[model samples]
Target: MAFLLLGFALVMVGASGIRPCNLAFGADQFNPNTKSGKRGINSFFNWYFFTLTFAVMVSLTAVVYVQSNVSWAIGLLIPAMIMLISCAFFFLGTNIYVKVKPEGSPLTSVVQVFVVAAKKRRLVLPEQPWLTLFNYMPPKSINSKRPYT
Candidate 1:
């Protein structure tokens, strides 16, 4: 029973981690600026959802039936084998995929903004609003020794 619960928890965690990354990764494949890119993105999402729904429906109906009526071992093995094949295909196409390098955590910037706002909360505004505003500057490269302003 404990092992079963642990398996469920692991599955929940894995699914949660994969769901956002999968959607973002798929959407990142297309540039939505051009007309064809826009159409491609739309079509990609439509097909993605359609296939997802179909898989869920089939799994719930057919897989459940197999597990309940047929051999449970075979039913369980089916998804495991499918997942193995999926991973194999993904790794095989690694060279063709658009691999984006990881940027620093976005949450840090959000926290910094809130901290700065709290620190400056008591400050008086200048007569001219423009005087208080600063121009947007891009962050320096990762290799730079200088800290982000």
Candidate 2:
């Protein structure tokens, strides 16, 4: 019972993480801004879904057939072996795959702004307006005429 509960939790976590990560990881393979890359992305997703559908059909039919007609252990072993092979292929291609670095979270900025405001609540403002308001100014790339919406 404990092992079953742990397996269920593991499956849930893996399901939540895998789909979004795989989609983003697959998308990272192509540059969507360019014509060729856009076409490549479209092609990739087209095949990806097709393969996914085919795999589902195969598992539903083939695995179930094997499990029913033959030994359940052998049927389970087939997929376990396939999963091992798939993992091996993924690791082999790791060097060629794009690795995206994590940028700091947006929430960090929001928290910093609140903390700064609270820390300065009792402080007197500087005599020069520019010195006091400098932190609130937009980046140099932003045009003064067009304030951020």
Q: TM-scores for all candidates? A: 0.69, 0.68
Report the lDDT of model 2 for residue 6.
Answer: 100
Q: Cα RMSD to native, each candidate?
A: 8.1, 11.4
Number of the top lDDT candidate:
2
Candidate 1 lDDT by residue in tens digits, 15-47: 998997887787767876888878988998999
Error of 1 at 99 (Å): 1.9
Q: Write the per-residue lDDT of candidate 2 for residues 80-136, one digit (tens) a residue.
A: 999999999999999998776655675776787899899989988768978757667
Q: Which ten residues in a row have the lowest lDDT in candidate 1?
A: 140-149
- Hey, what RMSD does candidate 1 come out at? 8.1
For residue 1, model 1's alpha carbon misses the true position, in angstroms, by: 3.7
Q: How does each model score on lDDT?
A: 0.81, 0.83
Candidate 2: 10-residue stretch with minimal lDDT? 140-149
